[model samples]
Target: MSPIELNKRQDTILQIVKENGPITGEQIAERLNLTRATLRPDLAILTMAGFLDARPRVGYFYSGKKTMTTASESMMNLKVGDFQSLPVVVAENMTVYDAIVQLFLEDVGTLFVVDEKSHLQGVLSRKDLLRTSIGTQELTKIPVHIIMSRMPNIVYCKKSDSLIGAAKKLIDRQVDSLPVVNETENGLEIVGRLTKTSVTKAFISLAETHDL
Candidate 1:
């Protein structure tokens, strides 16, 4: 998604193509005093970078695309549903002690609290459990709902939401993850989870896919 910096020969090739458009690779090589075989790699790079368009018989022409697709553009196109992980959920009535155990068992930083219908109720984070554990009250006696971040305060994203938007929510809300939810007549239904790790993996995938 980053800009492709052209080398000296590449820059000259681009300029040549721009001035004398629809030029064949052999012709361009002749002007540069180089063999077509020598320029093959550069032509491939330019075409793949969106700087040039190739045709069957017409040959290569300037595409007018100054650079590869911008990072912001690519990120905005990444949907949360594509990279979201399975939701780790717990009942709101579950004891904090059990929640902590579940957290460890699942190896997740956050848990979604739901009701009998599996509708979202609140969110329990490791920090919340840790803070409560240090208190005098027994962890077994306290329900997760007592400390979980309640709805209307919980920041979440839809499956169709952009990964970049979800990432921004994570940063602005200062949370490690966001619930990927679906809207129903009752309430929000947890479909998945978008975490910082998910975003990182998505970025890595994008880079590798684009050969950036």
Candidate 2:
């Protein structure tokens, strides 16, 4: 069945399974305020779609095999512009302490370091801040640019890249997030970011509907 044809209830069931795997039909019904009888059709359809699995006594669980395959397929189906978060950037001249404050305020793990023109310059992570903090040097005197991962070596995603592709990069590179860049006359400009947490959450959402 087309993804569009899946009703909201079915979608919710799949998501729940994805999030709380090895869940039971009764548990799903309780969460949705529906009866097991009413939810059977959805469970059946999701199982048929390779999105769910049924254990003898445990109830239902999401089939990881299906989740991975479906997530990959979904990623391939995305337009580059769809999965980006608006750029949250720090100026290169900003102090490490300033960047730390930004990181805390934004509740993000990384920050894009940008030049005066907003061109991609570097990337700063929480680790960098913590490591620097251990030294006797004053944070206020340390420039963020000095500690950031320099350009060219940075792994970035385009606004048009699929979420799966971005997630793969994050996993393979062992990075927390990727900056989304826009091609500019001078060079790539920082446009946004895609975090591993966000990608994982998306996958969990996708699995919530299945009974398994």
Candidate 3:
């Protein structure tokens, strides 16, 4: 799973909790000279992400679960094939309006643009559609290929890739997902999609296995 990037204050909050926990929210807030209300969101996020645990009256405490180094090593062992979802694809010539409809119907954040042979040609994202929609151009008149991000610009992965490596690409590229492809004589064939949700599921699976 992608690590949650904590802000300075959030990092400070975690340190305080680590050193003096089962500490109360109020006490934590006091140390930082902030209101309890102000610290509530950060505490909630840390707790939900499994960094901390809370008791009704006992307040908050670090979970002291597996260290980051150990968890990262386990995550590196995960393969993209194990966690990817089926690719949601659209024909390159498909109208932007139709692509938008297909996107919502499929409940996907991205649509892979493909040729007649199902070879990847480009990628269409929610941001792309939104940008098109707000323009004066008629959506139906425009083809997805016009606005889609085409290769050699696409970031992709193979089924054999490590999940951690693919996850890093997703982060560095700042894209919602990557097409999991298979190389063929013709081109790259879209076999699956590696997404943040997939990474999160992998992390949850890893956590469960550790507990077991």
Candidate 4:
């Protein structure tokens, strides 16, 4: 079935799953102001499109594994420019101590190291700082660039890419976060970061719908 054929209601059902999956048909109906019987066809189409899953006891759920495929297809149907996030970044010249402090204060596991021009230079993790600090290195004088994982090795995702794609990369690399880059006219620039924690939260949010 062509995605273009999906009606507004079907799209809405898919979105509801994307944002809140592992939900029951009754729950979805309530959110859309419809009865369960009215939503059956919509749910059927979404499940056929690989956007949703229905289980005996669970009722219905957004396919976490299939979210990437559905998201990529849905991008063509939705406004591409609608979703964007401004990335938080740090300078390459920042001290290790400062990076550590910032990581704690911001409650983030990774930090992006950027040049003065706001170009992505590298990435630093808590492990990197701790490893360096164990050697009796002076944290205040050391630049983050000296220890950061340099480019060509940096695993990143474009903002245009779906969250599922980014999450897959993070899982495959066994990393905690991914830098979101913008493919500008000049080069790739860091715009945001997506972390495992955020992905977990999204999943939890989706699952919570069933509890209610």
lDDT minimum window of 10 residues, candidate 3? 65-74
TM-score of each: 0.67, 0.64, 0.66, 0.59
lDDT of each: 0.84, 0.75, 0.83, 0.70
* Tens digits of lDDT, candidate 4, 1-212: 33234556766887887788778999999999997756654564465456677797777777743443443343233211112233557898998889989888887788888888888889898889899889656999998899999879899887556556677888998888888788778667886667777567444433332122
Worst 10 residues of 2 by lDDT: 66-75
Candidate 4 clashing pairs, residues 3+ apart or interchain: 87-191, 87-192
Off by over 4 Å in 3: 1-72
State residue 169's C-alpha deviation in candidate 1, in Å: 0.3
Tens digits of per-residue lDDT for model 1, 15-125: 999999999999999999997856754675566557888898999999998656554565666677767888999998899999999999999999999999999999998
Model 3: per-residue Cα lDDT over 1-212, one tens digit each: 43555666767988998999999999999999997856654664465556778899999998874434444555665678767888999998999999999999999999999999889999998999999999847998899999999988999999989888999999999999999999999899999999998888767656653442
Model 4 misplacement above 4 A: 1-86, 209-212
Report clash pairs, candidate 1.
none
**Best of the candidates, TM-score:** 1
Model 2 regions lying over 4 Å from their true place? 1-72, 209-212
Q: Residue 206 in model 2: shift from native, Å?
A: 1.9
* Model 2 lDDT at residue 185: 88
User: What is the TM-score (0 to 1) of candidate 1?
Assistant: 0.67
**C-alpha RMSD for every candidate:** 12.7, 11.6, 13.2, 11.4
